[model samples]
Target chain A: MARLTTPLTDFYAVIPAGGIGSRLWPLSRADAPKFLHDLTGSGSSLLKDTWDRLAPLAGEQRVMVVTGRAHRAAVEEQLPELADLNVVLESEPRDSSAAIGLAAAILEKREPGVIIGSFAADHVIKGTRFFNMAVAEAVEAARAGFIATIGIVPTEPAIGFGYIHATEETELEGAPSALKVDSFVEKPNAHTAEEYVESGDYLWNAGMFITKAAVLLEELAKTQPELHAGVVALAEVWDDHAKRGPAVDKIWPTLKKIAIDYAVAEPAAAAGKLVVIPGEFDWDDVGDFASIAKLHSSGYKKDLAILGEGARVLSDASSGILITDTGRTIALVGVKDIVVVDTPDALLVTTTANAQKVKSVVDALRISGRDDVL
Target chain B: MARLTTPLTDFYAVIPAGGIGSRLWPLSRADAPKFLHDLTGSGSSLLKDTWDRLAPLAGEQRVMVVTGRAHRAAVEEQLPELADLNVVLESEPRDSSAAIGLAAAILEKREPGVIIGSFAADHVIKGTRFFNMAVAEAVEAARAGFIATIGIVPTEPAIGFGYIHATEETELEGAPSALKVDSFVEKPNAHTAEEYVESGDYLWNAGMFITKAAVLLEELAKTQPELHAGVVALAEVWDDHAKRGPAVDKIWPTLKKIAIDYAVAEPAAAAGKLVVIPGEFDWDDVGDFASIAKLHSSGYKKDLAILGEGARVLSDASSGILITDTGRTIALVGVKDIVVVDTPDALLVTTTANAQKVKSVVDALRISGRDDVL
Candidate 1:
C-alpha cells in the first residue's frame, strides 16, 4: 500500500511463493521452488529480481512474502535483504487469491489509501523501467478508488498462460487510466490461444493486481463474503498478533480454500467494478524450465558445450543447465533439450516440456517409498 | 616343422598390444587401449584374458608379448604372470605381418617347431571347450605342416567382419583335419554379407592362427618369397645381436606395411598351401563399444541401467556401456538387442548395425580437433 503521492516509501508488496512449481521440478524441490533458483544465472533469483524491481515502488520493510513454513528458511536465506518479520509463513498452501486477502488483513492498521501491488514471485520481467512506471500508475489508480490489474501485451498465441479480455482506455483525471475489465479467461487450446493472440482485446492475465487495502477488503466483503468474514475475524486478532504473537494457522484452515481471483476479482470484474490497466512491460511468469531457458542467450537450439565460454548468464549445454561455480565446464553430446539438474544426491533429467510432469515423478517416487529420489 | 607329436612345454605366446585403436577413441586411448580395458570384466584385461586362456597350452614362463614400447608397462601390468623378459617391446608400430614375423624370429631360437597360436587380445571367446578343442586340432594340423587359421562359424550376415572362404575339408592325418581354404575375402557389404551367411561355406575371419614357426616360415618362403626373405634375413641373427636385435627397426620401414593375411595367407591360399580350421568356439571379437554391450543382458533395450536381469557370467550396474546418462532416469524402454554407451563427455546411441559407425564419429571428432571429447 502506498503512503506517498510521488513514489511510496510506505507502499507494500505481497508475493505468494507457496505454489509447488512442479513444472520447474528437479530444479524446484519441496525445500526450494522456482523463485529461489537463478534459472537465468543473472546474479539474481526470480524472487530477488522481482523484489529488487518492486522495492523502488514499495519499500523493503513494507514488502511481504507469503511462502510455505518449510520454504521460509530458504526464501530468507536467498533474500537476506528482507527483514525476518516481513516473511508471512503460510502453514499450508491456500492458493494466491486467499493469500492476497490475508496480507490485507495483517496490514489492516495501515491507511485506507495504502495501495498493495501483488506480484508473482516466479515471473521473468523485462523493461524494468516500464514495469515500475506501470506499478506507479496502478498505485495512482488505486488511490482513486479503482482496483487495477495490469494486462500484458501478448507477443504470441500462447495457450499455456491465462488471458484477460480488456476494454478500451478511459482517460482519468490523475493518470491516463485504462477501462474496466470485461472478463477473465482460462488457458485455451491452440485454436483459442491463436484467436486470443489475433484479437487485440485479449491481454495476458499476469496475476498482478493493484488496489488499496480498503477497496480490496470492501470488494472481498461484497463478492466473497465468506472469505471476507473469515479475514475480518482474523483481522480482529491481527493487532494482538502484530504486537505480541499468535499463529494464524487455526484461522487459515477454517477459511474456504479458493483463489482471490475466483472468489473476488472475477466476481468484481463481472459486477462492473474491476479495471484492466492496459500496460506494456515484458512480463513472463516463467512457468517451467523451458521458459527459464529463454531468459538468457545460449546455444539452446543445438548441441553444445560451455568449456570456457566464460561468464555465461545461463549455460544450458543442450538440455543440461549449469549454474557452475564460476568457469566450470558443462559438456553434453547426443542429449536433447532435457533439464539435467545435477544437485548433490538428486539428478533430474526430463524433457523441458515434461518438467511439469516432474511432480508426477516425485509423487510416484513417494508412493513407491523412494523418498531418496525426492 | 613337426618334430614331436606330443604337446611340448615352454611354448611362448606373443601379443602385439601396440595399435592405437583409433576407432575406440574415448574408451581406448593411446595410454590405455582396448586390450587394457576390462571390456570382458572377468577381473582381467582382454590381453590378460587371452593370456590366461593360452597360458596352459604355452607355459607362463614362455609367454611373450610383442607390443609397442609405450604399451609395454600396461601389457606387463595386465599379464603379471609374464616376466619382464618375455614382453618384447617394439620401438614403433609395424603392420601385423611384420609383427608376427618379428615374433617368429625371436621364438625360432628358443625351441624349433614351436607351436605358436597367435591370438588377438580383444576377442570374446565363448564355449571354451569348443575353442580349446578346435585350437588343439589346429595345433595338430599346424604340426603336420599346414598354415592353419581358425575360421569362426557365421551366426549372422554381419558385414562388419572379414570372411574366410573354405571350399572343402582336406583328408589329413590329424585331430580334426583342416579345410582347404579357397581364399580369404575382405569385409563385405550387406548383400555380400547376406550371401556369405546363406552360402554356409563362408566363415568369419577370426584373426586367430595356429602354426609352428618353421611351418609358417616355410609357407612364407613358398607363397611370399619377398616377405620370407625379409623375415629370414631378420631371423638369421636369432642368437646374435644384429638382425635379431633392432635390425628390423631399420629394415621394417623398407618392408611394405601390410596385414599378414594380405601379404602371406591370401598368397598361400591362392598357392594351394592354406588351411582353414573351422573354429567350434563361440568367438566374439568385440570390435567396438557395441560389441562390449552384447555381453550385457537387460530387460530394457533403450536407456538400460543394467541392474542385472539374469545370473549371467558378469554384471555390474555402475559399469556397462551406457547410451546416454543425461540424468533422465531411463526405464530402458523395453528394447531388445541394443548398445547404449553413456559417457559424461559423449553418448553413443546405436544398434549393432551402426556400432561400427562409432569409429566414424571418433574420426570426425579427431578431424574437428575435439581431442577433449576423445
Candidate 2:
C-alpha cells in the first residue's frame, strides 16, 4: 500500500453520523450521540476526527456529511470548514441504507461519476500512513468500476464485529492490495470466529464503503428500487432550499429502514462486483467502556485507567476504568476490572466483563420511562 | 431487662462525637463525619439518633454533646433543643479520654455525684425497649458505686469489635443483670473470636461507659493524671463565656490523647470496679459501607441495596450498596457486591469485600494534599 501525498481526483468523503450508541449511555445520550464525543483521548470529537482523517484524502470542499435534522447544527458547528451544500440533513433516520444512499444520490446529482467514500463518524482508526494508503487503494479500486470497502485486518478472533470473506486469487487491476469479496458474514460464535481468524481469509467489516456515486445509486436501484427512487427524488430537489424540506418530509418516512450491507454490499458481493481493501490500521467502534478502557490503556496506573479531561481520581489496589464527565474526585478501593462512569445527572457502575450488559441498563431505563437520562 | 418508663434522676448523657470514618469516605468527610450522616435509613443523623435514644433515658435537659469546634454549628443545628451550655466545644481533638473526661468534669462541677453515661454519636442501636432497660440497669449499677458499661450480647464471631470478659457469678447488688468485668480484650483473630463467641462469656464492648462523674474523674486522675487535671481546669471556666475559650485554648492541647477504654475502663476492669450490663439490643458502629449494607439489607432489590434520600437508581444483576448524596440516577449492570458512594465533590467505587480498604484511599488523598475533599 503506497501513501499518496495529494487528494484523490474527484474523490468525495461522505460521513453518515447517526445511532444513539445506547451501550454508551450517560455519555452518549439521544441528544448527544457517540459521534459528538471523544471516546479516544484524541482531544477532538469523533465527528471532527472523521472530518480531519478524510480531509487529507478527499479535500475539505469535496467531503459531505449525512446526519439527522436533530444533529445538523452540532455537525455543522464541529466542522465549520464544511460547505453548506455538502451536508445532507435527513428529516428522520431510515438507517444506514437511506443515509449513505441519499448522500450518494445527492453527490451524483451534483456531479456525475464522482467517486465517494462513506465512513462512519464514530469509528476510531489509528496509523494515519496505513489509513491513507488503504483509502488511496480503495479509491483506485472504486475507479475500476467496482464497489470498494475497506475491511480491517483482524487482530483477534472477535465475535463482536461482522466479517468480510475475501479471496486472494481475484484482484482488481489497479489496486494491488484489493481482494474480491466472496461474502459478508454476520457476527460469529466464539468457535466460528476462531476458525475465521485462523483461516486468515476474513476481515472485520468496518462499514467503510468506497465507490462511484452513480454505481452506488445504480446498485441501490437494482436491489431496493423503492428506496433508491425515494432518495433520488429527494436528491433532485435537495440543492433547492425552498423545495428540499417539502421533498424530504414527503419521501424520507416512506423509505424502508435497512442497513447498507443487507441492501447493497451483500448483493453486490454475490454478483462478484465488490472488492475489499484489507486495512492494516488499528480500528475500533468505541462501542462500550471496555473498548474505551483498551483505547486508553496507556493512562492506566496499577491497572486502573481514568478517562475524560479534568477527571480527579484516586485509586488504590483497583484494576479498571473510571470515565468521569464531571470533575468530581472518584476514589476506587480494591475493585478489580470495574467500570465507573460519573456524569452530572447519571452514573454507571459495572465491570469490564459486564460492559456489553450496559445496554440492558439503558433498555431498562427506557422501559421505566427514564428517557431523560437516555 | 425490664423497660423503664421515666427518665432516671441524676443521670446525664454525654455523647463523644469524633472520628472522620475514613473507611466510609466520599460520604464521611473531615468536616462532615459519620455522626452527621444517617447511615441507617432512620430519617435522622446518627448524632441526632443518639440524642433521641438517650433523651428517653436521661431527659433532654440531662443530655449533652461534646464535639470539636469545627462541627459545633452543625451539631447545634441537628440537636436544636439542646441548651447552649450543654454543647461542649473542644478546640482541638485530644481523643475520647479528653472529650468524655471534660464532660464528666464539667457535670461534676455543676452537681456533685451526677451520673454521666458516655455514648459514641456514630453507633446505631435497635430495640429501643431493650436499650432503655439496659440503660436503666446500668444506671442502677452506677448508683451502687460501680463504673457500669453496657456490653452488647454477641450475635456473631465478629473480629471487627473489641470484646468484654464478664464473670456471671459476681453480680451487682442493685442491678441483677450486671456482672463483674474480668477483662477487656482488643479485636481478636478469627479463631479467637469464634472461641469467644462459642464460650458465651464475652460481649461486644460498645464504648458505652456509665459512672458517677466524680468516679470517672478519679479513675482518670489515677491512670492519666495530667489529662485529668487539664480537663478539670478546662471544666472550672467552661461555664464562663469569656474564660471558656481561653481555658480550652490553654489546657485542651496539653491533655493526653487516649481512649476511655485505655484510660479508665480497662484499668477499672482490672481493679474489679467495672460492671458489664449485658445489652440485648442490636448495635452497630456504622464503620464502613459493608456495615451499612448489612444495616439496610431490607432495601436490597436482587441483592442490591441503596441508602440515601432521593437516590434514583436502576440496577440489573448487580448486588451490594449504593450510598448517594448527589441525587444522581445511578445504573449498575452485572456488578456484584460493589459499593458506590456518590457525593457532590467526591465519589467512591469499590465492593463490599473491599470496604475496609477505603481507608487507604483516604490516606492516599490526604498524603496527596487533597484535604479540601476530605
Candidate 3:
C-alpha cells in the first residue's frame, strides 16, 4: 500500500469510477458503464489501459480504485491481480469529494508521506511516456507541499471540460513542477471556450491530481470542514474495514454532495495554496461518442467511415452491407454532425450539436416510466 | 365415385396448387407455397378452405387435386383422410393444361362419364351459398354437353383479373344453363377494366370450369391434338399407373408448353361450344398481401388503434403487446394503418398500401443476396 517508485516514491495512482452511466442506454446501463465496455475493440477497457501506463511508476499495489458496489464485480473481472483490499467500494453514490476523501483516508493508514495521484477510470490517454513523466513531476511538487492538479495541453476548444488559469511557474523538482493556478473556470459556451483555448496560459483541467494525503486533509479541514470531518470519521472505522463497514455505510448518505474542486481545490487556490502540473500527455476525458473519433491517428477518416467528409464516422461496416438489421451495417446518409447509434431495439439519431442533450432521452424515458428503454 | 345428384349425374371439381411460392420470401419459400400457409388465422389453409366448400357438392372422393411432385406430402398432411390412390402428383411443372390432363386421364378410367370442374387451390370465396348454387347450375349445363367455365360476378374493375364476355344465356330443364362466351380478355389496364365492369355482359374469368370429360377430350382433340395425344398416351397405361408413370413423365417434357384457356377454350368458342356459367359466389384470388386486408371488414382503422372509438371488432389494446425482443421495447406511437413485422434478421415498416410491394423488397433482397433476411 506504500507508494514507492522503482527509483523513488513518485505517485500513487487512484481511479474513481463509480457513476451509473445510464446515458449509453442499452449498451451501457446501470449494471455496466462505458468504462467496462470494450467499445474501442482494442481488447482492453479504458480502466485497464489507464492502469497499464501507471503501474511502472506507482508499483503494482500502489495503484488503488474507488468504485460503486454495482461495479465491484466488473472492476475485479478487469483487474484480477488487483487485491480485493485495495479496491474501495462505495456503499452508494455520494460524489467526487467523498470518493477522494475515502481514498485518502485508506492510503494514510498504510503510509504517512505518500502522494495520491487521482484519475477517472474512463479517461482515454495517449502517449503513456509523456503522462508518466508529468505524474512524476507532479509527485515531486506534491512532496514540496503544493496540491498539484494536471492541466492537460488543450487539443481543441472543447466546451465539455473545465479550464485552469496559470499565473507563474514555481521552481521545484523533476520536470516542470508547479504553477500558481489563477482561477478555475467551469465548462463554458463555444465562444468562451474558443477564447480560453486561444489564451496561452489556459489549460483544460484533466481532473487528475497529485497531493500529499495529509496536506489534502489539512486543506480540506480549513476549507470544507464538513467533508474533512466525514473523512476523519470514516478513517477511525477503516482500520477494521470488514467489521465496521455497515456502520460506515449508515453515515454515508448524510455526506455533502460536492466535487473535490469545489469543496477543496478551488477554495484552496483562492487562499493561495494551489499548483498546476502541466501535463505533457495527450489526453481526452472521452466525454461522449464524438470524442472517440480522436482516438485514431487518421483523424476520423481511415479508422471510421466519415460520411460527407468531416460530418460523421460510420463504424460497423462489413462486406458491402450499407444497411443491416442494426448489427454490422450502418448508413450515415444525408446526416451531418449527428450521433446516430443503431442498436437492435432503439435508434438514437441526434445531432452531435446536441450530444449533451442525449441525457434528455433517458430523462424522458424515465419520466414516462419506460425502464425497458431507459 | 358417381356424380349422381337426385336424378342426374354431371360435373366434377379439380384443384391445382403445385407452384412453390418464392415471392413471399422467408414465410413462403422454395419448398412451401401459398395454399399451404394458414394466412387467415383460423389455422386452416386456403387449400383446405377451398376443399371444405367444394366437398358437399363434389363429394369428398370426387373432389380431386393435381399438384407437383414436391407438394404431395403437404397436401396429405392438410387432408389426412385422403387415400394415396385419389391424389395425383405431377412429375414436373409444364403448365396448367398438362397438370389438368394428368388428372383427366386418371379420372376417365375410374368413371367414364365424369364431368371435371377445375378450381385453384388458393382462392377465397366469401359467398358460399351463391357459390354452391352456381356450381349446381353449371353441372346441369355440363350434362347438356356445354363446356362451362364459371364467370365470377364482378365486384370491382380490378386490373389483376382476366374478363369473359357472356353475350347470351340459355334456359333449359328448369335451370339457367349456359351463356355463349363471345370473347376472353387478358388483365387489362385500369380504364379497360372499368369499361369491362360497367359493360354488364362481362365477368372475371375465374380459371374454373365444368365439363364432361368425354366432351373436353373431343374439344381438345379438335383444338389441340398435340395436348389430346399426350392425354391419350397418359391414359393408355392409366390401368398400370405405377408402372407407366415414368414413361408418361418422359413424354410430358416433349409436349407444347401452353395453358388450357389458350389451347382449348379460346379456340373452342369459334364453334360456340365454350360457354359461361355465371358464378354467383364471392371469390378472391388472394394474389398478394393486400388481399389479406380484405378478410377483415374494414380497410382502415376499424380494427386498429382508434381514437375515441369503441366499436372495435378486434383490438390489441390493454397489454396486447407483440414484442419480439427480450433486450428492448417497441413503442407504437400515433400510428394506424401500419403493419409492424419485427423479425430477428429484418424488420418491415410499411403501410398496407405498400403491402403488395413487399414482394419488391424480397426481390431487392434476392438481388443483394441477403439470404438470411430472405
Task: Report the number of clashing residue pairs per model.
Answer: 12, 0, 1
Judged by DockQ, which candidate is best?
Answer: 2
Q: Which portions of model 3 show Cα errors greater than 4 Å?
A: A1-241, A244-374, B1-10, B68-70, B91-95, B140-206, B214-232, B235-241, B248-283, B293-297, B301-374
What's model 2's lDDT at B64? 89
How well is each residue in B1-374 modelled by candidate 3, as lDDT tens digits?
Answer: 12324323444678888655543333454466778876565558888998887777776766788887788888998987566766777777777777777677667767888988888888788777777767776777778887778899898898778999887877644347468889898999999999988988899988887778777778778877887888778777766858577766677777777788887778867678778878777787766544554554344434442111121111122111121222334433222344433334444443445445656656666676765444
Using lDDT, give the best candidate's number.
2
lDDT of 1 by residue, B1-374 (tens): 23233334634566766666655545566566778766655767788888877776667776778787788777767777887656666667667777787677668756777877788877778776667667776777777777788899898897769999997878766655479899898999999899998998998998777778776777666656776677667666645655455765666566556677876688778887778778766787778655666565332334333411221111112223443323433322222333444334443433444456666666666676766656
Ranking by lDDT: 2, 3, 1
In candidate 3 the C-alpha lDDT for residue A185 amounts to: 93
Candidate 3's displacement at residue B92, Å, is 4.6
- Scored against the true structure, residue A17 in model 2 reaches a CA lDDT of 92
Better of 1 and 3 by TM-score: 1
- Please provide, for model 2 over B99-152, each residue's C-alpha lDDT reduced to its tens digit, 9 standing for 90 to 100: 999999999999999999999999999999888888888888888888999999
Q: Model 1 reproduces what portion of true contacts?
A: 0.01
The digit string of per-residue lDDT tens for model 1 on A200-277 reads: 888899988888887888888876788787776766676566632343766677677888788777987888767777
TM-score of each: 0.73, 0.96, 0.60
